[model samples]
Target: MNYAKDPADYPLAAKDPALFVHQHEGAVSWGAVFAGGVGAAAFALILLTLGTGLGLTSISPWSTGASNAKALGFAAVVWVCVTSILTSGLGGYLAGRLRRRWLAVDADEIHFRDTAHGFLSWAVATLFTAAILTSVVSGVVRTGAQTAATTAAASGSVTMEAMQRGNPAAGMNTWPLGYFVDSLFRMPAGSPPPATAATTGSNETPRAETARIFLNSAATGDPLSPEDTAYLSQLVAQRTGLAPDAAQARVTTTYTRLLQKISAMNTAAKSAADEARKITIGVSLWLFISLLMGAFSASLMATYGGRVRQL
Candidate 1:
């Protein structure tokens, strides 16, 4: 009833008495696999460090002599492929050379075992390197997030005040309604502009109110309501010494320009996102190719090592 207990059920073992005698010994040489894997990982780390140093030397901080990003990326990919082949071949050779040789196993079975050993070694090395990199990346991300949080906490009130007052010097990219609000206060040609400090002090509430109206319109993708338009025009006229009619026209023109700018920003953002997606896909494919190179190199070198062992 038990397959292992009855040797009669195993046709090959029944015919070959020598194979039955050594059947108890396991096929895999775990010690060899582990040694090869650790050696490969260490060698890979050394190669990576060397490559990084070489790459840094090739690049220049000054624009004239510096290698462009695209060129650097291509060089990195080539270096990765080279590193994979060298490291994996070394691992495979060690695994095959050090593995326990079989006395009674068939040639085909021996070949398969050697191949398996090579593959396992490569897998272990890859996993070890990945774990190391993952931990490093996680630590860096945590540190960066903590730094950003601290900076934001310290500057929160100042940033909010600057945004509300439509301060042009307060990082334009951070304030969504800044351009539109500033357009509202633009004076006619040859007219002197208002003093920034005086305007900020006296019209703080009105500036904040106008920014809110612009933000709401932008969010809703709708033009300002008639009441809001009239009120904003009156406020603009009072602030800029313009006629009511001119202020109303300016408001209409500025709101139209704001919508156009928003549409342009959305398009640019989508384009940037699409570009990033393509780059990610390209990098992933290259990584896959590099891994395949490692597997093939390892298997080939392991077969060579096994043949040498027989000699």
Candidate 2:
């Protein structure tokens, strides 16, 4: 046997980890991995802020000034991919270059270790960035909600009075429901002023009752029962000074319209929810793709950095 031949060429039973631990147990440079990860996370934050500024400048609240949403969305996807590549590539290079060179390891093993270091760096960076972003979004949402609550509380009484003035039958009902309820007692043009019996003092009880009926119908998705229809029609006739038959017809029309409005509202809500689901799915898929690109970039760049360091 030649004395100069490599020892690695002769396979050793010592390579079996189940039997014995290897000597190169401290091969990983965790310090370097952490440094690279933190650097990458900082770089990602900078890129994200830049992207946000660019996005804000590119669109407007006014319809004519705003960029097309689909175009903006596509641009955002592209930016994410570019940001991931740059940040991960930099992190991977740093991780590979900062590590202490391994001695006596086979080339394949060195390559594998370098690749692992890069992947680990990328993973750490991803976790750090996610944590930062989550904290920021949570803070923003919390602040916005608190601000809105404060504003609403401050103007509650004034807003309530304005709404009541617009819809006298509203009482304590919400604005939308109040609007529909007010329609029930509207008198024909040129009709005599509503009788003194229909004055605010006398109208409150029936208005409240009508509001309750509408609310219950909306909640149950059921039309008014016959007893309710007749009772409500009688109330309308007495208040509006309309003929009994005309009041009954108006009751039928108003109830039918209310049901139609409720059905339309339900449809709109479902449509909006479906749209939101689709947007979320698209974002998730694009994010996955971006992350995959980051991993590939990191691994590839690490290999290059490792070769440069070895040289």
lDDT of 2 by residue, 171-274 (tens): 34454556667789987899876667656787777877887776666555677888888899899998888888898888888878866776776688789899
Pick the TM-score winner. 2
Q: Report the Cα lDDT for residue 236, model 2.
A: 94
Q: Model 1, 200-227: lDDT tens per residue?
A: 7677667667767766666657888999
TM-score of 2: 0.81
How displaced is residue 154 in candidate 1, in Å?
4.3
Candidate 1 local lDDT, residue 113: 84
